[model samples]
Target: MKILLLLLTVSVVMAQAQAPHIDSSYSDGQIQAFLKDGFERNDRLLQAKAYYLLAAREQNGGINNEYTITYLQKSHELFAASRDAYHLHRAKLALALSYVDQKTFDQAFDLQREALTYFEQRNDLFMATHAAASLANTYKLMGNLPQERVYLERCETNNKLLKDNILSLAILNSKVVNFQRQRQYDQALSAAHQLLTIARASKKTNFEIAGLFFEGILHQFKGQYQTAIGKLFDCLSLISNPNLSPEAMQCYLHLSQCYEALHDYPHAYQYSQRYGQASHAILNNQRQTALQRQTLRFDAEGKRRQIANLEKEKREAEQTALWQRTITIGIGIAAFVLFCALFSVLYFHRQKTRSDQIIENQKEEIKQKEINELRQELTLQNVQAIVTGQETERERIAKDLHDSLGGMLSTVRLRFDALKTGQPTHAYEQALDMLDNTIREVRHIAHNLQPDALLQFGLTAAINDLVNRTHSPATPDINFQTYGQEFALTPTQSLTIFRIIQELLYNAIKHAKASEILVQLNWQTPSLMILVEDDGVGYDTTQIQTGMGTKNIQTRVAYLNAHLEVQSVPDEGTTVVVTVGV
Candidate 1:
């Protein structure tokens, strides 16, 4: 009975000690007690997260890097279990920044790019912008100004629409520094002013301080020694020491530049020494971290050998598995071939009928092209006749203007000059208004003769203006829409598209008396498709002999190496679709 009681008591104590921990029990004492027992455990993931949370709180501004890095490294190791792209990206970004803060610029730059690639592939623009900003800082620290500018521009491009106010202003500030580095005083000062404006407009403290420091640095670069010193002093007074790393480093460097230029040897030497000390400390920290990495790498190498041996054994086992999979796939392929052989009998019968239709289609296309060429010849002749008639009409108008309006305008101007210089007469004003109206009318006629705006502005804008002006208030509705990316085209291509739309719309409104029109330009697969649709009297396409308008369109389409399709009904509507490689 005594032995039984002792055994029972020991078993109860062991069971109590092995009790599972219940997370989120809302008991701080229990958590502290649990942590006090051991910092490490069998569950690496749990231990890593715990150490991470603790190290984050214990960093206290990175005063003790030994403890901080140890925890970060452990957290990094356990992150492999997550094996997610975003998690890896986050860990790599954090490690890179830590490297940057420690002044390990080369390694920081390399790792930052790796993080950036993952963000870019996922189209996570916000994180990409942040990564680019960090990359810019790393490049600048390494004295690679051009590379730094490239990264800053990327940051700006990504955040242009996001309106991450602080980041946007920082990008501008970085560009100003780049300009100053190149000794572009006027441009640099302008950029600096722009940065200050952006930062103030954003109403962010960090951005505002960044702007002010950069503004002062601009003055220092411009040889305004005393002004630069005062501004730098103002910046220093404005920010607390804890918020001082980036700006303070800049201040020291710029002041050293200013003092050395002004021949203040002692002050220059003192600042140079200060810079050396700060830089040396940063470098020493990096060296220690590198040594730690090297030690980890040596340890990892031994682990890698062990892993290789295990992998060899695993691979040997996998070979037989792979062979079995291959055999299974071979059987699937053989079965697929049998099914295909049975399918081919029906497929061949269908293909024979399709081949006949394809040949007929080709013949029809060739005939259409020949017909189009003949119609274009006739349209060219018509255009020549129209031009000749217009010129004669214009000559008649010019002769009238020279003989009639010229004399009247000369007489009126002479009479007006007879009056006092500042005197106004209602009669005179009325006569002037009359003359202005006539001049405007004449200009309108000339514009109808030849449109310069159509030539200067793009095809779409020109067509839109034409539709607005020509469409009567009581006339049928005209809807115009566009899609795909717009880019600069050669003047001739623009003119051709404009002319085609004008001719098509004119034919629809005048000949067909169309009640409605829909003009659409869009990307259809790899080519651009322009469709003009109207509801009006439609002709049988069987009467395929091309008219003048049809000929002009066909000519333009040929010039563009495009395809055109026309579908029409007797009373429903006519739709014209043209596809061009654009």
Candidate 2:
């Protein structure tokens, strides 16, 4: 009995491992119709198969596992009652998978063993290999390394017997994972390399990527930071499916750690941030998907109830018509007229209900849009706060240098001049000149940190001063213009605008190599507009890499609830326009 149980358990595991992929192209309505047709035909086998397919579809759609379990149970019953051992085993295997999902490991193990026995009796080496692999995974999950190793070896041996290199490669991949878990890096690396070679030769992109990921992990464990980074990046470039999010998340996290170990704090921080954002996005997407699936299931259930009620009403009408037929002609005419009136009333009520439903749906859509807008607003506000904090810090630093450091330097120069009373020597003149240059350089640095003109004279004068400073015979000819009525703005708004203009000018001069630049600030009654144009060799905006300057500009613009437009064509001038409600 124990041997039989073990065999059954194996069969169940294999069945789950070999579950067919659900084709998402088919609509839920079509699947339901197919199932209904099978049931109406009273073909038990067909009904069982249909139910199994439905379960698979539900599983793939990420619907509640209980729904899948219900379908699988029905399929299993039908197959068992029909005494179709082969199909019954398949049903059992599917049921085991559902049980596994529900964390009923004992039941799953029992079903898997049964499935294995069935496959072995039929001399099905491929399925037997799949069963062994599943068993290995189960053991791994249970933390029974010895048992896991035994099954993994069995899986590989069976794959070899079947003469399937792809199956063998899969087993090898699993072994690599097991080896990694055991901290046997050498074995893991060896297996990963073999898997990669086979996967590449077979043109299996997914397996090849997986192989690359394993290689990266092995290298990371060996403290080969550079090699690991390259391998991990390669894996990331090849991953397109959201299902591989966990792998991608690991890559990002490990890359962050590797960079940190190498004392590259900036790269480390960047990767860590990427990992956090990716993880949040993945979780959000999963939550939304699950909610959508639940909504769809509820809708389907409501439709089914409506259909059942309609059928019930139709049956009653048929019976009433039969009774009416037996009545006299006069009564029959009256009955027919009464029926027409009742039908009209029912139709009118249905139409009214449908209209109400439509209105409700529209309301829900509008509410969802409002919620999304609020979320975006909150995100922008957070970014604005960060930018504000950074600017405030810069201002503080500038103030310190201007007041404390500048004052001390000036006092030092005064003392030096007072001490040099006697000799008008060459050394004294050179020392005076050096001291003057140092003071000028310090002032320039302080001004750049938080421009004094921007704080004292507001946005227009600051922009004008900036234009004049950037204007040189060797540099581009920058033109500044103002239009509309000049209006007052809060200091924060003025500062943000000034910084944006500064970045734009810097980009034009340094990157674009412009010969001519125009800066315009227009303040109307309720709005403010700024435009910066440069006659320079532009770039492909789509391919433009967003640097710190661009990011800062984006943050400030979002904070101001503004619109920004940039038009750039290769070999032509670039124009950037920003409009904000005052």
Candidate 3:
């Protein structure tokens, strides 16, 4: 179970570490706007950069993969057209990587080699080292271990000269992969160990996990089934989300194989089943990605056709205008004047019609805007009313339970104690104990109905109390921390925040099955940030977006006009960050 749990998170780490760094300072809309601005200003360089940025963004998100490649190609063209050699080579490198991802090794190899030569010629070791590493990876994928080794050697030399730990790690990873492919188990194992040491020293858990995985593979290839199982399980133990990790799938498959070799049918079957599920999930993801790329391709093609048609129409209109001018030049002055007068009348008539249409459209738009605003206001009011009513009812119930039922239970316990003291009977003592339990249960219910600490102490104290109440040996340990000076909040805001945190905690404990949870509050000058994180079996955010819990949280978030970001990967855990204007 521990092995499987660790395997689950491997994807999360690998997914983070594997992606190229992308600038997210500007949004997709902003980038597109910049692209438009560049076109309008006849700035090819700006347009090229925008296209590259868009491609990088798409690559990072794994969206529109085919369109991303197209964007990179266009960016490369624009850079070359603008005589930007450096950017052109950079774009070529991006394009090559994209081709590698798509398994088009021929194109990838050519482009990568070109970019590599450019960087090497300039003695740009930083870029050259990465280019060599990428080329090696491409060769590795193509089953050309000799070529891969050649590039790996180059990468090693460059890294040695530069003394870059990151570059060294990349080189080591490449060597491990190449050695494994070459069936040099001893060399591969050594490289894996070195990789693991460097990864651990650098605190790169993802690389460490990768090294462990490679070690297990090497051991398995050497026919050390038990040793391989141990190493594979070690790899799995480090991962958080096995279902999403290809490494996890490999781990499961190898574990199954190892168990089968050991004649452990039950364990083998269990791992085989896990491997099947992981494979199915991965296949589905691949299919979805392919479909998205295909859709983007279709959309791009359609837009291209539309642009072509529009340009054709513009050209035809220009030709007609030229013909009209040439005919008018040959016509008499009276005929030309009469034609101009007729054209002016028709144009004015069309202009008046367009103006009327525009006026009506504007009026309709204003009406719709007003309706939307009114609807939103009503929704807010309704939510506020419902919450206010629920709190009021909760308060009433808590008061009744505490002051009425609680008092009665306590009184009964006292009377039973007094009677027991007089009689000194076992029956009376048992009744007294029962009364004590009843009294405690009533108080517990009352406390839950409406926490007095929240009403008296503020958000910080209330959260602490919640953490204390939620924590137990059977539940995930809750860690509560606050930073910055505390700020005051209205009763509603305080309650809403508390409820949001409470729901998050419940989800983490009950659904996530986490071992640990962290709740943080940071009160800044204008905004308060609340973060709830858990190291639990996470869920697919896309799949769970419309869940009731999510909807409820979103509603509360809307009420506060707050920004909420939820990042989760299967088996890795979930992190929810909410930023609210104070």
Which one wins on lDDT? 3
TM-score of each: 0.36, 0.46, 0.46
Better of 1 and 3 by lDDT: 3
Clashes of each: 0, 18, 10
Regions of model 2 farther than 4 Å from truth: 1-41, 240-246, 300-582
Which candidate would rank higher by lDDT, 1 or 2? 2
Q: Write the per-residue lDDT of candidate 2 for residues 369-415, one digit (tens) a residue.
A: 99999999889878878978988898898888889998989999999
For residues 204-316, what per-residue lDDT tens digits would candidate 1 score against the true structure? 65666766786787777666888888777776676676222546666777778889999998898877776666666667767897787766556544643543454465466
Question: In candidate 1, which residue ranges exceed 4 Å CA deviation?
Answer: 1-48, 58-60, 63-67, 101-110, 182-187, 225-582
- What are the Cα lDDT values of the candidates? 0.67, 0.79, 0.81
| Model 3 lDDT per residue over 1-582, tens place | 112112211132111211212233455456656666566566778778878877776665556467779889989999999999988888887898789888999998888888889989998887787677778778777888999899889877877888866566667877887888788889889989999999899998888898899988788888899999999999999999989889999999999998998899999999999999999999999899789877766655664455345446656766888899888876877787898898998999999999999999999999999999999999999988877887899889999999998888778777766666568587777877777878887887788778889899999999999899778789978899999998889989998888889888887887998889999999997899999999999988778757677777888888888999999999899999999998
